[model samples]
Target: MITYRLLHPEILAGLAAAGHGAQVLIADALYPHSTGVPAPAARVHLNLRPGLVAARDVLEVVADTVHIEAAVYMADADGGESEPVREYRGLLGSHRHGGDQEVAWSGLERTDFYAACRRPDVCMLVATGETRPYANLLLRIGVP
Candidate 1:
């Protein structure tokens, strides 16, 4: 029986196959899932409909499932931290339900973020139904 909130089989399996230093991308609906990450990366589509699922929701569950070493956000061109980025920081910074330590985090330009995702270290890509702009988050797994 499942003991945690993250019950999706594919997601669970993908995460299970990943190890420390592996990356996971939980992105908004607008993200280009098909071509964003490398070919070896496992893909899970939770985009049922507009706003059906939120990136933050996925992040919360993923954080609970894995020890996140770092979080990378897709930044705005103006180099400003968006609302979603602030919320992500608050969630990842505190010793909350999912995260036990303050995570090392940063922001990357859209292209830079996408390029980062294309790297082979990304083991999973979860495309959410979040409608908010700049709601994407990329996580690097750490030791439990």
Candidate 2:
């Protein structure tokens, strides 16, 4: 039996196969999982119910298991902004890593975020039932 917090089989498998610089997306409930991501990347749906599991909830688990070099959050193109994005940036900043391992946030447009998910480097996608707008996240794995 597994003792870790994240016991989901697909999430475990995806993390095990991922390496440094590989991208893993933790998408919000409303994000279009089917059409946004490519076919090759593993897609795990943890969104059982509305707000049952938030993006941050999944982020904490993924952060614990993987070496995260950088993180990207969706932003408003017209500068309308998002509270969740601000909170997420703060959360990532509070985490400290060893030499050459830094956690930083880069704001990407909604379209840009979608474009990035289509890249060949993306390894997996976790779709959570987070109803908050702009709650989507993209994590870049680092060397362990």
**After superposition, which runs of candidate 2 have C-alpha atoms over 4 Å from their true positions?**
97-100
- Candidate 1 lDDT, 1-144, residue by residue in tens: 987899999999999999889999998999999999999899999999999788888888888788888889999768777888888888877533233666888999999999999999999999999998998889998885
| Winner by TM-score | 1
lDDT of 2 at 68: 83
In candidate 2, what are the lDDT values of residues 36-76, reduced to their tens digit?
78889999999999997888888888877877888888886
- Local distance difference test, each candidate: 0.88, 0.83
Clashes of each: 0, 0
